[model samples]
Target: MPSLRMFGRDWKVAVDDLAVYAGVAGLWHVVWVIVEIVFLARATAESDQPCIDSEIHLFTWYMSVDIVCFLLYALLLFYTLRGSILDVGARKPAIYILYGISAIYTFLLVINIAASVLKNQFVAPCQDAHRERLALAIFICHWIFWGVWALAALLAFDPFATTSVEQRYAARLWLLKCCSAGASEARPGAAEHIGEICDRAYSTQDEKMESSTPMSQIGALMTLVFTGVDMTTTDYATALILVRNAQRMDREDALAAGVGKPEVAPIPLDMLEDAAHYLPHALSIYGWASNVLNKQDIAAWGCGASCVAPCTGKDVHVGDNMLFSSKNMTIQGVKVMTKSNPETDLLYMSWDNEIQGLLPYYICIDRPRREVIISVRGSLSAADWMTDLLVLPVEVDANFLGCDPSSMVAPEDVKIETTASRRRLISAHKGMLGCAKTIAADLRRHKVLDAVLKSDQHAREALKHDIYKQDCSDHQLVVVGHSLGAGVAALLALHLRSVYPGTRCWAYAPPGGLMSPELSAAMRDYCTSVVCGRDLVPRLSLSNMEILARQMIECSARCKQPKVRVILHPGKKWKRDDLFKPEAEMSADARKTLEAYMRNSGSSHCAGGKVIEARDFLTPGKLLYYEANDSDIADALVFTPQFVDNKEFAKNGMLISTFAVDMHMPWMYQMAVDKALDDAHRGLPSTRVEVAKLEGTCYAPEAAAQTTQQAETDIEAAGGRPS
Candidate 1:
C-alpha cells in the first residue's frame, strides 16, 4: 500500500500513486457512460414517439453519445496519456497506440451515424418485432463502444499502475538525464571549426535556433528572387524591342526623325543561316520531365546517347511525320523512368533553336548509382568523331553529369549547341544604354512640347505665364496617349528633369518598353507614370502586327511573356451621321493598322484574349462606374448614355477620359476639360507663346540678340505666340 498527500488531503492507494491517478481517470469514464445511457433514454422519451416509430429519436441518441465521447477522448488523451502523466519515455508506445485507436474509432462512429440517417430517410415505419430488435441493438452497440473506449484509455497508462508514483517520478528523471547527456555531446563539435564550412554550419544552427531553415526552402527563395528579376529584365527588353520596331505614328516618327536608333537590324536569310552554323550544341533540361518544349529535327551525330537502352532506329518510336530541316538535327528518345517511382524522368535533353545539327556521339549518366550509359544514336562517323574527341582520363560523377550538363566536352561529344555572339554583343551594349535610348527616342519622336505649343497656343501661354515667372507650377502636367503616344509620354517624363532641367511630367497607360537600367532609375526619379496592368496597347510591337500574330502563337507556346503588350483602341466618334462599327466589325484598313501596331510592339497571342478589359481601361472599377460602388458585377449600371445609343466602349472614350472618369465618377471628361480651361483663364495670361530668332546675319553676338528680339515680336504679332 502507498500513501499520498495532495494539496493538504491525505489518500492511500492499494498499489501506487500511478494506479491512483489511473483509477480516478477510470472512475470518471464509468460515470460518463452511465450519464450517456440516461441521456439517450431521455432523448427518446422527449421525442413523444416510441423508438421503433421514430428514427429521429435514434439519430439524436447516436449524435449525443458520439459528441460526448469525442470530448472525453480528447481530454483523456491529452491530460493523461500524451504528456509526462505518470512517466516520460516509459509509455511512448502505449500513448501512440491510444491515439491511433481513438482516431479510427471516432471515424467509425461518424460513419455509423451517417449510415443510420441515410437508411431511415425513405424506409417506412413498422410496428414489427424486427424494428424493435434493431433499435435495441443500436443502443447496445453504443454502450459497448463506450466500454471498449474506457478499457483502452485505462490500459494506456499502465504497468506500474494502481499506486506507482515513486517509480513514475524516477523514470522521468532518468529520461531527462539521458537527453542532457546527448545534448552535451553535440556542443564540442560546434566550437571546433571556423572556416567556410564552420561559418555555414554556425549560420544553420543559428537559423535553427530562431526557426528552422531547410536547404530546399533556401533554394526556393533564391530561385524566386532570381526568377522575378530575370522576368522583369526580360520584360523590359521585350518592350524596347517592340517599341523600336513597331510601325505606328510615334514609332515611325522616332525612326524617320532619327530621335532613337533602331534596336535590331533585319538580318538576311543567308546571314541568319551562316550565323546558325556557329550556334552551340548542348542539352537543356528545365525542371524535371514535365513536357518537351521544342520538337525540331536535325541529322544526328552517330555516337550520341539515346533515351532507349539499345541504340537502334527499329526500337525508336519517334513520329515519322515530324520533318527534319537541313539546318536542324534532332535525336529524340521516348520518355521513360528507370526507377519504381514514376516521376524521375523529367526534362532530360534540350537544345537551343539557333543551331540544328546533332552531334555524332551520345553518353548517358545514371545519377543515383553513379554510372554512365553510352550508346550510338547516329552514324559510325559520329561515334568515331566522339571517340576521338571525348576521351577523358578521369571518371565523371553521375550527379555532375546529369545536373545541367553542358558542351565543354570535345567536338565529337557535343550533341546540341547554340551561339549568342550577336545577342551577346546586343546584351552587352543594350544592358546599360537601352532604357535611356528608349525614352530619348520617344521624346524626339513626339516633339510633345513643340506640338503642344503649336496646336494649343493658349495652353502653352498659360504654362509660361504665372508658372514660368514664379516657377511654382500648380498645374499638373499629365501626358496621356495610346500606343506610340504612351511610349512618348513615358520616355518624356523619364528624362524630363534632365532635358528640361526643372519640368515634371505625369504619364499614363505607357506600354512596356525597353529602358536602360540608368534610364529606368532616372524615370523613377523624374516622373510618376500610372500603368494600367492589363493594357495591351503598350505591348504592341511597331512591326507588322498581322504577321507577328503567327509568331506570337509560337512564342506563347514556349510560355515566354511578350516583351511588350499591344492594346487596340477603336476609333473615336465618327462624323454625326456615320454608321457605328464595333471593333470586332472594324474595316480591313483599320484592322491592318491595329495589327501593324501590335506586331511592332511585340504583342503575343494569348489563348483567351487580351489581359485587361476595355471597360476597366483606366483607374479602378469602383471609381469608374457608380454601380461599381457595390463591388458586384450583378449590380445594374447607374447612368444611362446621353448621346447615341451605344455600349460603354463605343462612346468617345480616351484612356485619359477613362482615367478621369474613374477618379471623378458622375463627371465626364468634357466637364473636366471645361473646368481646367476656366481655371487657366482666371489665373494666368491667355497669350504667352513667343518665337525668338537670331538677330544679325548669324555673326556678331549683340546684333544676333537684337535680331532675335525683333523676330520674337514679329512672331507674337503673327499669332505664333498666344494673342
Candidate 2:
C-alpha cells in the first residue's frame, strides 16, 4: 500500500479506507432520503391523497436505489479489504462489481438532481413550495459530497494503476491486439517495428509519476468544484484509452521516411493582383449584409435599405474602409433576397423585410477596369451556418438554376461514352445551389444581367447609376464572395456563364464540398478559388467529416485498457500547489491528432451506395493556395501564393489547429494576398519551388484587352461605336 504524510499528518489509503468513505457517503444519502420521504408524506397527507401516486413514488424508488448501491459498494470494498477475495483473478470480479455500483449511483444522482430542479421550477405557488426548494438544495449537496468523495478515492486508491509498470504492459497488449487484428498488417513494415512503436506510446519522464499534468489537475479541480463531477472516473479512463490508441496509430507511421508532396504552380502575377484588388470589397460587403448599422449609413455607402436600426458610432467604424472611394467605379443598388418572401424583391427602396434566409448581393461598374462586379456576403448569422450544412448533392439542371426545365434539351442521352470529355456537368451542394438559384432568380426578375449586358436606359434605371450611359456592354462580368458567399458566387457564376459569356468568379475560401469534380474542373476557365493557410472551411466536407469519425472509432477500438489511475504520493518535494502550474503546451495533442488524421486520411474510404463518391465533391475552379514562406528575412515573413492541382485541393482535410478558425477569417485571406503582392514588388521569390504554370484566359490581362477590342470592332462593323 502507498502512504503519504501531509501537514505533519500520516495519510494512508487502502481498500478499507475506500470502504469507510463509501459507508459515510451511504449514511449521508440515507439522511437526505429520510427527510425527502417525510416531506413528501406530509404534502400527500395535506392533499387528502390515499397514498403516494406512481409519479411521486418514482422519487422514493430512486432514493432507495441510491442508498442500496452505495451500501452494496461499501460492503464489497470491505470484503476485498478483509482478503475474502484473496486471488487477484477472483478479486477482479469484486472490483468490477464495485465499479458497476458506483456507475449506477452516479447515474441516479444525476437523475435526482435534474428531477429536483424541474420540481422547483414548475412547482405551483403554494405554502409547500419551500419544501421542494429545500429538497433541491439537499440533492445538490448530495451531488457535491459524492464528487469530492470520488476525487479523494481516485487520489487515494490508485484503482487503475496508471503510474505503475502495469500501464506499459497495458499499452503493449493494446498494440499487440491491434497488430493481431490486422491494423499493423495493413501497412508494410509495421509488424517489424511494433516493439519500438509500443515503447514510444507509453514513454514518459518517470513511470511511477502521475500522468496528470498541472493544467489537467486544475481542470479536474474546476470540474469537481464548479461542474460537480459531470465526467466520472470511467469517462476519464475511456479518454485515456482513446488517447493511447491514437498514439499507437501515430507511431505506426513514425518510421515512414517522407510524405508525398503535391505539385504546385505559382499564382499568375495578374491573378494575384486581381485577388488583392477585390478582397476589400469582398470583406466590406459582409458588414453591409449584417444590417447592423443605420439605414441612412448603409444607403449612403451604396448598400440598399438597412434591415435594422443604427448601431453605435464605434460599431460603424469597425472594419469600415473606403468601399466606394474609387472615382472610376459607380455604386449600384444592392439586392437582398430571402426565401420567406420570394415574391418581394428587397432593394435600396424596400424596408423592414425579415432577414430570414437573406442572401444579399450588390452590383457595381468599374470604368477603369472595364468590369461589372457582383459581390455577395459570407456567413454572419445562424441562418447562414444552416445553409452551409445543407450539403446534400442535387443534380444540376435548368430547373435547379431557376430556368425553364423544358428548354434544356428534352432530357435524352445524358450519358455518353466519353464521360470525362462530356461538357455537361452533374451535381452541386444543395445549400449553395439554393443560394445560387435565389441570386439568379433575383437577377433575372430585376433584369440585372440585362443591365450589365446592354447598359441602355433600363440599365440606368435598374442600376440607379448614370455609368450605364457608357456602353458598359464591353466590360467583363466578375462575381466575387468570401466563405459561404464564395460558394454561392461560384455556383452563380457557373449558371450565369451561358447567358453572359466571359463571366468570371473570384471565390475566397469556398466550401470544400461545393460541386462535382467535373464541374470544378470545367469551371477552371472562369472561376479562381483562393484558399488561405489551414482554413478549415474549404476542407470541411461530408466525406472528410465521415473519415474523421471513422478514424476516431478505429482508434478507440484498438485499445484494450479502459482504466486510468492517479498518483497521490508526491515523490520528493511536498509542494501541494505544484498540481496547478500552467502547462507549456496546451494544443499539442490536437496538433498531433490533426497530423495523424491528414496522413492516414488518404487511405480511408467512405461507405459506397447510391450516394455520390466523396472524391467527386470538391471545391470549384482553379485553386490558389496562399501560405506563408519560411524565409530568413528578419523584417517580415513572405507569403507565397501558388495555384495547386485540384487533387491536392481535394486531399486537404479539416485542420484542428488552434488557429484553424482564425485562418478562415476574411482578413487573413486579405492579409496573405497583400503580403504576396508586397513580396512580388520587393523582387522576392513568390514560391519556394514551382512545378508548372497554368494556361488560362480568366486572369490574363490580354484576355480583357482582346475582349474590349473585339467589342469595339463588332460595334464599328455594325455601323460605328455607340454614342
Candidate 3:
C-alpha cells in the first residue's frame, strides 16, 4: 500500500489540490443558496408573512431543504469519515452516504422533471406562474449537483485509497475498460481484484506518484471521462471496485459473519512446480520462438526479432542470433545462461548457398545439460531443390558411416555402392553442401552436373573442423529441421553419431525415402520425425503419387488449352510396392513415370526418425500434442495404411487440405515442438495420434543409371550453369 509518509512533501500538495476543489464546489453551492434566500425574502415580502408556497411541494421548500441537507451531510461525512474515507477496506457509513445521495437525488430528479414540465405552481400553475418557473429550475439544478457530488464521493471513498496503483486508478475506471484496455474500458474476474484496487489508489499526490500509476490506466480514465462513456465514470468505477472488493473480502469476514467458509484455498504443491517450469516455456514459445518467423527482429513485447524471413516471399526464414555481440543480428536482451554459468555466450552456424546468399542457422549449447542443438533451414530455390533432385546412388559406406575417418575416402566417381541402398538415391546437393564442395566451379562454371554428384571428405573435414570450433563443450548434439532441411538433419545426425555418441535428430514433416527404414531404425533412439495432422508432405512421397498421377493426367488434358500445369507422372507407389511387391501394382510405364517424378520433384524422401503428429490447434490458441510410432508416421488416432485407406480418404474429400499441406511449414512444426514441451511440463498426456503407416517391399533396381541424363538437362534449364 502506498503510504502518506512515502510522499511526505507531496502531502501538502495533495491538501492544496483538495482545498482548491472544495473552494470551487463551495462557491458554486453558496451562490445558489443565496439565490434561494433572495427568492424566499421576495416571496415573504410579497405575501407579508414568513411563509411562501410554489407550484409544487417537490419544487418548493422540500427541494431547497433537499439541496441544503445533502451539502451539509456531505461536509459532515467528509469530516466524520475523513480518515475512513481516505483509508482502505471501505467504511460502511461513508459508502451508505454516497449511495444514498446518488439514489435519493436520482429519484427526486425524475419527479422534479415531471413537475417542471407540468408547470405545477407553488399554489397553482395560474396562482404563482413566475415563482413556479424559478422553483422548478432550481429544483432540477439542485438534483444535478447531487448527482455530481455522489459520483465524486464514490471514487474518493475508502475502497480506492489503499489499492495498488493500477487497481487504484483502475478502481474508478476499470469498469469502464478492460485489463488489456486503456481508459475506454473492457475483465470477467475483476470482482475478485478489489482489495488490490484500494492499496494502489493512493489518494495523496506523493502517494499517487509513488504508487506508480501506469499510463494504461491513465489512458483508460481519459477515454471514459472525455469520451463521455458515462456521466459519472469515476463514481461508477469506484462503486464497482468497492463492491467487488467487498465481495472478495467476504472470505475474510465469512465466519465472522456466520458464514461457513475458509479464507483461502491451500496451494497444490505439484501445480506450483508446473507453473514454475512450464509457464515460462509455454510463454517463451510465443515470446521468443514464434517471433523468429516475424520479419522484424523485435515485436511490441520486446523479444528479439531473430526471424529475418521476408514476409512476402516463399523462401522467408526466421532464426535468432543469441550472442549479444554479433553484428547484424538481434542482440540478446537477457543473458541466456547455462545451469552452470551465470552468464553465457551462444554459437552461430551459417553457410553460403549459391541461390540464397548466406543463411545462418541457430545453435544453442547448454553445458550443464551437456546438450547442443543444430537447427537447419529448408530448401528455398529451384537450384537448392536441384541439389536434392540430382541424387547420387550411394549407400551408407560402412567405412565412413562409423568413425574410421582414416578409412573414409572420397568416391573416385559418383558410383553405386553394391552393398548400399542404391535404388533410393540420397540428395546429391544436400550431402555435398554438408561437405561444402557442391559449389565447385566445375559444375556451375563448366555446366557439368557429374562433378557435383558426389559428397567427398570436404564435408567430413569441414564438419569436423566446424564442430571443433563451434562446440560449446556439450557432448550431446540434437538436430532439428523442417521440410527439405529434415533430410539433411537426419543424415547429419546419424553420420555424426559415428563420432558423437549422443547425437539425436528431429525431422518435422519430412517426405518419404529421405533415409532407409533400416537406417532410421538403426538410429531410432537418435532420430524422431514429427508429422502434423495430415500434413501432406510426409504423406506425399507415399500415397500422394495418386494425386500426382491425376494431376499429370489433368495437365495432359490442359495441354490442349495452352494453360500450364505442374504435372509430374506418378511413379510406382513406393508404399504399395513395399507392401505387396506386386509387379502388376507398378507397370514398367508407371515405374518409369514415378522415377521421373521423384527425380524432378524430389518428393520421395522420409525423415529418418520417430514421427510425431500435432494438430495445429484443437481449441483456438490452445496447443495440442501427439505421439508418433512408426517406420513411417502413424497417427494413432486417425492413421490408416495409405494403401488400405487412401481411396476412402480421397473419396471423402479429407485426403489433403490446404491446412494439412501448410502443416508442413516451419511455423506449424515449431508449434508442434513447443506444444510438446508444454504438455510435458504440465504433466498432461500427449494427444495420441498417427497417420496410416507406409510398409512394403520393392523391387531393387540393379544400379539404376548412376546419374540420369535428364538430371543434367533439368539443372541446366533451371539456371544452375557454371558461374
* Native-referenced Cα lDDT, model 1: 0.28
**Model 2 Cα lDDT, one tens digit per residue, 130-168:** 655765665566567667756775554433312222222
lDDT by residue (tens digit), candidate 1, 1-723: 112222232223111213224435445545645655654555455455444334554445465555554554444434333221112233334334334445656765665666556554423443245544554565556656656655654543333213222222223333433321111111111111212221231232434322312221222222111111111122223322332222222323433555421111111223222112111111111111111223322233211223221222123333333212210133322222122111222111222111012222222233443322211111123222211111111111222122222222334433232421111010111111222243344334433333232233444353332211222122223222222223333433334433344443333323222222223333343333332211233222112122233332222222111111211112222121132223454434334434533342221221111110111122110011111111112122122101110112111122222232242211222222233234334543222111111110011233444434443443333234332
> Each model's TM-score?
0.18, 0.49, 0.33
Model 2: residues with Cα > 4 Å off, grouped in runs: 1-265, 288-358, 398-425, 459-471, 559-610, 613-615, 628-638, 686-723
Q: Which structure among the candidates has the greatest TM-score? A: 2
**Best-matching candidate per lDDT:** 2
Model 3: runs farther than 4 Å from truth?
1-343, 355-359, 381-383, 395-400, 403-474, 540-547, 550-655, 674-723
Q: What is the descending lDDT order? A: 2, 3, 1
* TM-score: the better of candidates 1 and 2: 2
lDDT of 1 at 72: 48
Question: CA lDDT of 654 in candidate 1?
Answer: 20
Give the least accurate 10-residue stretch of model 3, judged by summed lDDT. Answer: 612-621
Backbone clashes in candidate 3 total 56
Q: Score each candidate by Cα lDDT.
A: 0.28, 0.50, 0.35
Error of 3 at 91 (Å): 90
